[model samples]
Target: MLCGKSLVNNFYKYKRKVWQNVIPIIKRHNATYHPPKILFFGTDNFSLPSLQALHRNCSDRLGVVTSFKSPANCVRSYAEKEKLPLKKWPIEPSDCSQFDLGVVVSFGHMIPANIINGFPNGMINVHASLLPKWRGAAPIMYAIMKGDASTGVSIMKIEPHRFDIGAILAQREVVIKPDVFMPELHASLALLGADLLVDTVNNVQERLKEAKLQDNTNASYAPKITNKLTEVVWSELSAFDIYTRYRALFGYKNLTTSFLGKQVQLLELRIPERELLVQEPGTFKYQKQRKSLLIGCAQDSQLEILQLRVEGRKPMNAQDFNNGFLKGARSLNFTQNKLSAN
Candidate 1:
């Protein structure tokens, strides 16, 4: 027979043994076992989803860090609205030393070595593309422009001096629907990135331990969008190429060309099923039934110009444009001008 004190001692020993075995399992699988203190860095609307996710998952969110070059920084607005702490860029290393980790999304600034070393767990970035593929400032734009079949989000460590050259901690891929345009794709990728970021940060240590280096041989770049890409080279680009460019540049810039000695912007465009009678690229014929302009393009392809705006004029539908400007004009042509013809 066991004494009372002896029985209590045995029971405690058994409980301790059980817990010791279970603790490792719990830590391995539990996402919120020990939420890390996070310092978030972001500036644009694209960064909002990640910050919002971290706030929901982490109880120890320290603050937001951003260098606000634009007047409309959504991250700054969000931190203010939430009454969370906010720190401008170029923060001192000592200030963020207490934080366990740093999260960057669309921050657009190179973090210094001292600042990256402040966090005990180091910094991770939520990039909008599957890294090594489109690694630069405008991954989303280039992905849409290049008409890739698929794209995804990448969670990676932040290496100093370079943009997006980091070991990937995690990644999640999404399909690019055939008819999907830039704004829709951008929104979808942003939300997907946010979810992946939360999951990665939840088990960051394990993810970091299992990080994989990107294959530079298979790497590609997405340079910043420029005004030159918006120009419509009618003689050089196929109708499909023009339509793809329009889809990619939607909500960013419209395709521009010179029409009848004036600069004209192609606002709304569609791919035409049947070719027009005109064979020369850039020539157009107004389709009476369709209420659109069938414009010739390279490789015998044709595009429907649904809406356009001539220089110093309000945007008009194809019907209105034809009625107002193309009255009695059939063989009007769009030209590649050497200078601004406005």
Candidate 2:
């Protein structure tokens, strides 16, 4: 039989073990007990997930600040529907001081120093690309265009005037699948940014304490997409290059070239499984049996163009295009240069 003192000692040991196991769970619960007051700056559908997450997890999401160009006013519409406070862009400094932190995602404007200073914890941005790489408005598009094998999201401090040069608070990487297109990549990165943003916000002060300054020297930029990028240079671009560019611009823009003096938009492109006989780049061979158009490209590569649209006409499959446009021409070729009207 145990003595009273032994019984007391055994009870204390059991109590200590139970507390050891319970303390971490209690700490985790307490960590989120007091949600911070947050002012969210965002625009576009890409920013929606993060906003929704913060609203669901935090009690004090003060309001949303967005630009006039909110991609069909998606963010604004969501804010209004949810009855969340919504403010137009160029938020006043006077109104910002009450927030504990500012979270910016795809906001499209640089927050002024005064506005950033207004928040007790300053402002942090959720960028779509890994810091020091593809830092700008169209990171996802650029990542696809450049054939990057991997891309990611970064939670960083927002510096005035400059963009994507902020100190990184956290980063998360994702693989770029060979066949992934713009919308898929964009959605993946958006969700990743949202997940990382929530974690950073939950322990923002500690994260800020350990923030790492970005290495500007090693940085690369992803500028806005322009029409000029859609023009395909068949001679200079490989099948992979054209296909990747098509994937990158999918749903945003179409790969365009000049076909027999007419503007032709390559609607659907693919890398051909088998190589074609060495031919001059920009020249195409219509495979009547397969109903596919094979365009010669750099380094003996060939691109299979399945769908296309001639300027002033509706989109059509290769078979229809060949039957109507080709008219049984012996040799047909595409060119990058738009021919001058005679």
Candidate 3:
């Protein structure tokens, strides 16, 4: 038994470990039922765990269906490892009809209506957000990018028409922390979705009655993320806002902030505890003595740029980047590329 001091220490130490322990919950569901004859539809790492959970817990699997896309070839590796049947895209309705059920997780493509009707039980999807919210591609990143305080995973029956517009089967909510980045959040939700998926399969008959129709009235779409959204309009955003955006977008994609037309790639940044004087937003202020870089934002907040890449230069830390260009400069006008030697 942990004493008071050790108890507090363990709590801090295992706080993240606690989240990592969701695999057991999935394992528990395995024993309760025979594996459903599932045809899994997925292509990326996000779908990997759910397929694994199904392979472990459920038997009589039909196979895995995937596109031969790069960057998300985990499905193929997994199928080979498990010695499971693997089928590529343009799948026919006949292929889907052989399974007792269908499961989709981050599959990134729609299951056609012909395939939908083939399953006697129809299809179930493990979506990363609660129904009617973040109901599209890129839910994990969008939740963080929009600064949502809490987001969740939802297991829903698939509608033939679209993605994530179905009735809710189950949901598990997680609070967002300022420090949690996109990859961390993505991983957590994947495991959570797996747990929910197995539970939904076991309780589908009973759970369907409890399934709530989504309130389309409150629906907000999380559009697919592209390079265009990576553009940081510094003057229009707050430090806190940009910080959240950067956190969500950085690990998985490039984050570039441009002034007028010139782009600067940010390798890293941090929000410090110290406050700065109010200044016009988007002003870059550097301290030569302290070897610091501070950029002003809305609400008088400051963003400390720790690492950045100027054009025609390699990435550098604040102390190093300041050496040649920003040593004596106080403030630089980003638009005109003018130094405040005035």
In order, what lDDT does every prediction score?
0.87, 0.87, 0.79
Of candidate 2, the 10-residue stretch with the lowest lDDT total is 333-342
Clashing pairs in 3: 35-58, 35-59
TM-score-based ranking: 2, 1, 3
Write candidate 3's Cα lDDT for 1-342 as tens digits: 559889899898798687668767778765555655888998888899898888877744549988886744998888877889889886988997778788888888877888988988888899888768888888889999998999989998898878888888788999988789999999999998988888888777777778789999999989888777766666777888888888888677766765434467777878877786555766777666555678877777788788888777788887886676665654464432212111
Model 3 misplaced stretches (Cα beyond 4 Å):
1-33, 60-62, 259-261, 288-290, 327-331, 336-342
Off by over 4 Å in 1: 1-32, 276-278, 328-331, 337-342
What is the alpha-carbon lDDT for the whole of candidate 2? Answer: 0.87
- Which candidate would rank higher by lDDT, 1 or 3? 1
Q: Estimate each model's TM-score.
A: 0.87, 0.90, 0.83
Ranking by lDDT: 2, 1, 3
lDDT of 1: 0.87
Where is the poorest 10-residue window by lDDT in model 3? 333-342
